[model samples]
Target: MSEATDYSRETENLDNCDVEAAYARWAPIYDLTFTAVFRPGRRALTAAANKADGPILDVGVGTGLELPMFEPHTEVYGVDLSEHMLRRAAQRVERERLSHVVGLYKMDASRMAFPDAAFACVCAPFVLTVVPEPEAMLDELARVVRPGGEIILVNHVSRKDDPLAALDTWLDRHVAPKLGWRPQFPWSIIGDWIDQRSDMELMERRLLAPFGLFTMSRIRRLPLSQDVDAPVMPAELEYA
Candidate 1:
């Protein structure tokens, strides 16, 4: 194959095999291996959900880890791209008798089936880097959430100045192939994308504990206005 074709095929194979297969293999040991790493973000997301009004959507709700944390009265829905993960999430709902969990679906975050303005709050935890097209997924989230709705994100952001930056880069280059995640995902690209959008207003940003490896952000979707500037894509970053 030509170099371009080879790269394309490799990317296709990675997309088809990486996410679902990796999660399927990890499903059995996921809680044991990742629960501690993800717990802080899950806690922050659920805390935000408890305070938000109306129904909430948990995007990338892997194994329903945050499902039980939601208040019993809050109506919550969850969606994940991996059927194996969604099945586990469904089982958790049943095992825990979580009455607040409205539904779980196998759905792509980039092209969600939800109707417009369906949720009051959208939470994406440790998911942005996993998706094939993070920008498209963010647009889908914006579309499904009501005006003035909150969007909460908790994910690891790469910092070039961090002491562990070199280690993170090395892992992204070497270990990511086996682990199936981009450990050194570019935070600058995501930041620039969010900054260019007129509809999204950054409300708060805080570094999560235990070495500040992750960041939690609270952003509000502004109500549509005629005066709002048309969203212009940043030329420096390509959606992937």
Candidate 2:
């Protein structure tokens, strides 16, 4: 088969394999294996959540990975694309006896089903890199969050002139084969894209460690008709 055909076939296979199904296979070992490496990045999200003013909605909340951060709150809602992941999150909620403070649902990130301005805060960690249409997911997130509320995103992306993009390209072509999905970094384009959107304001950007790596950004809804360009608060940087 041609290289393009091979890559296409591989990505299709990965897409066909349900993410929940794959996570189900990963859940039993999730905390010990995967979650451990992600603590630093998650910590940045916790800090953002603590600062947000309204109700929090965690999109793609696999196994409630970011749930603990919403402590002392009245309630937090979590949505995931996978039923199995939701099941896992439900179990965590019950284990923590947070039934009154936590709610879980199964939903897609690309096309959020919530009404406009339904949530006070929305978060999608590592979501942009995984979803097929990252911009669509962002649009949906912006749609659901209340005016002046915050959107906290933790994601991975290519470093300009870093040469790592080639590795990601290789993974998209090779490693993702049989897995059914392509590798993507939504953050690379996010900064420039958010700059153009009048509906949102870029509040902060943090550059994480190990070669200008990983990043977390907080974006808030801008007042209607406010100039997208204006002096704003200085962003913070976090090194992993």
Candidate 3:
């Protein structure tokens, strides 16, 4: 058998060019275009986060579609690459009276502003594909989450055994990246990342409804003999 291809480099990398700008453009109509289709995944991830104690971080929180899904007691902070999208999220918070939403910050996921192990969990909904460097963002996710806490994600992952493997591959190279997301994203981009990490472990992987088009993964952060200092709120970072 031949060596397996690393599909992270299999595509043109076109989508990585202007993710923030692309999402800024999408902000105006993002909810209208995706709210219905993405609702189930939002519910699934938020419900799981709700069960855990302590604070939660919502990365790539576009237009804050999932903000209201959290239980009122769940203290949630949000971050996004798109200021345009985050503006809409602020409006949604006030309009919907989502008080559990602790704060919303305009920042890069790859280089977050929070302290190490600052959260109980981190949830990235349909986000891994949009960033220029997914591995860097994963590093930040692992950094901010407390040991034994979870890093949850929902993404469109492509598999070799998929019935549409041929079409997915064609689109990934020719079309998907241009659309600002790697719809035909290879599982190794994620699976291999998990395998190489000693601090993280795949706790759960499941397919979302309306067909197995989206995958939701939950990764647990293993406690080390030398854990980070206790999570603390940066005085300047936390909003009143």
Candidate 4:
């Protein structure tokens, strides 16, 4: 096959692997390969999560990975697009005897099934980078969270300090495609989307070990006319 034909074929194959199928394909080896690779994200995410309030929603909560980090008094809900991953998550919840403290659902993160203001906090670790269209997911997250609620995120982003940002761009375009993660958009830009709207406030930024980054933000979806006094920050979440 010609190089162009090969590329097209690969893209087509990746497009067919939805969350359920992709995750199911990786299920058996998922923990073994991803556990150590994601340690940075877990540590950073837990620190950010520590600041969020109870009644948390873990969107794209694959395999109940965040269960142990949840506070004992807090009620947690895990949602994912994969039944297989949700099953694993459910098993973990049962094993931990957290049936009373946790709930599980099979759902899409881009179109959340929950009601507006349904959760005090929303979290997703290492999920946004893999999502097909992250903006849609962010919009959904913004819509359902309560005012002053937090959106905690932990992600392995393309390093910003790389000279020319070439490595990051190349990884997104080439390496990520092979993994079925569309690299059309770099991962570092997530904060820009979160802070651009008037409803969210960037609260904290921390560097996770081994190169992950975490952000803790508060939501305030009211129109600008309603909150003329709100502060604004640069894309870096840096404020004067």
Candidate 5:
């Protein structure tokens, strides 16, 4: 292991080294395993992004499975913690001629390099609980998204009375430390933050398909007064 990869045992929840090692393993087979499974959530995110104006940022854009889903006219910038995964995304961009994919950067979700309010919209799919501090990461998402724009997130919000709590506990103890994510993440992490902030508001919270295990949240940044961005169409609306 490299010096960076050798630091896995240093942090409890911030198993960033673990994350690095985990994705390095997953990068090769990630799309093969997760693409079909995660496509619906990506569709929901990109479809909303397509409706809005200006540029979009996809954080934790692993392998950029959602890259080609964007409209040709839609400008997109992607960032991920894993260079191993990004290589695949770069290849996909080249292979498919994704001219609208402006850039793919290796960056931390908690501390990005972009200027404040730099993007019209920022979307993070399956990323919140993966990082060491999800709230700080959420704050970063809020910081970069423009006042009238939005931040969209897709994640698994553990139920208060979760029947799978035991399974989640086992995963956190064994699997998540290796994977560098919190599988039984709570809704309060996102909700309480929104309640405290005057500038951010949760516009929508919708459960996803395939057993309703996933959730999508659309949050708008307040601007005193501005037209809200177009909302993401629901799965029902999509099929109807």
Candidate 6:
């Protein structure tokens, strides 16, 4: 096929395929390959979960790597779009006898079935960029988490000034379809979205290990009474 036609076909496939199919292929060897690189973020998430008040919701809980790390007394629920990944997670839960893991459902993060304020904390680890609609997923997370609850995210955010930025962008555009991740996704997308909301408070943003490509963010949901009309951050400041 011509180069343009090949590119068009690839884009079409990416749009049509659900994340599950991509992850299904990766599930079997995911832990072996990514466990080391993602260790710091997973540890941070576990620490956050241990300190959180009530039940926890782990969105995009691929292979349940962090499930066993949660405190034994903390009740944890996990959801993911990939059944194959969830199956691996289920096996881990059983093998480890991690009773703290209350559930592992195969569900889309953009439209979680849970009711409002269903959880005390909602976390998405290395997940934001992988979803089809990250804004919708965040909104759903906010809806399910209690007013005073925490929302944690651990993901890689592209930096325009980074030396690897150009290469990352090229890889994201050319290789992400086969690799199942958007390596060049910008932090501005989430930052801009969050800046317009009045319902959450930004608690922290810290870089993780492995060259600081990844970051961990903590946000606390404000009570309904605190909701207010706030001015959006300036375009230049959105990614700052």
1 or 3: which has the higher lDDT? 3
Which residue window of length 10 is worst by lDDT in model 5?
A: 1-10
Clashes of each: 1, 6, 0, 1, 0, 0
Q: Write the per-residue lDDT of candidate 4 for residues 63-89, one digit (tens) a residue.
A: 766677676777777777666667777
Alpha-carbon error at 16 in model 4, in Å? 7.5
- For each candidate in the order shown, give its overall lDDT on alpha carbons: 0.80, 0.68, 0.82, 0.64, 0.83, 0.82
Give the alpha carbon lDDT tens digit for every residue of 59-176 in model 6: 9898989988899989998988776788788888888888898888767787777889999999999999888677888898989999889999999988877778988889887877
Q: Report residue 28 deviation for candidate 4 (angstroms).
A: 1.3
Superpose all Cα atoms of candidate 3 onto the true structure and report the RMSD in Å to 1 decimal. 10.9
Instruction: Quote model 5's TM-score.
Output: 0.86
Candidate 6 similarity to native, TM-score: 0.87
Model 3, 1-240: lDDT tens digits are 011111122234444446765777788999999999988899899998997679999998889999999999899988886777888888898889889987888777887778998999999999998787888889989999998899999987876667777887777688654566765677788889988887788989999964777889999998764234445567899898
Model 5 Cα lDDT, one tens digit per residue, 47-158: 8888768899999988889999999999998888887888888888888998998888877888888899999999998889888888899999989999889899998888
TM-score of each: 0.86, 0.79, 0.84, 0.75, 0.86, 0.87
Candidates 2 and 6 compared by lDDT, better number = 6
Full-model lDDT, candidate 4: 0.64
Model 3: how far residue 204 lies from native, Å: 0.5
Candidates 2 and 5 compared: the better one by lDDT is 5
Cα lDDT, model 4, residue 223? 41
- Report the error of model 5 at residue 94, Å: 0.4
- Candidate 5's displacement at residue 191, Å, is 0.1
Best by TM-score: 6
Task: Judging by lDDT against the true structure, name the best candidate.
Answer: 5
Candidate 1 lDDT tens digits, 51-88:
98899999988888988999998999888877677777
Which residue ranges in model 6 land beyond 4 Å of their true spot?
Answer: 1-18, 229-240
RMSD vs true structure, all candidates = 9.7, 10.9, 10.9, 10.3, 9.6, 10.3
Q: Which 10-residue window of candidate 3 scores lowest in summed lDDT?
A: 1-10
Lowest summed lDDT over 10 consecutive residues: which window, candidate 4? 1-10
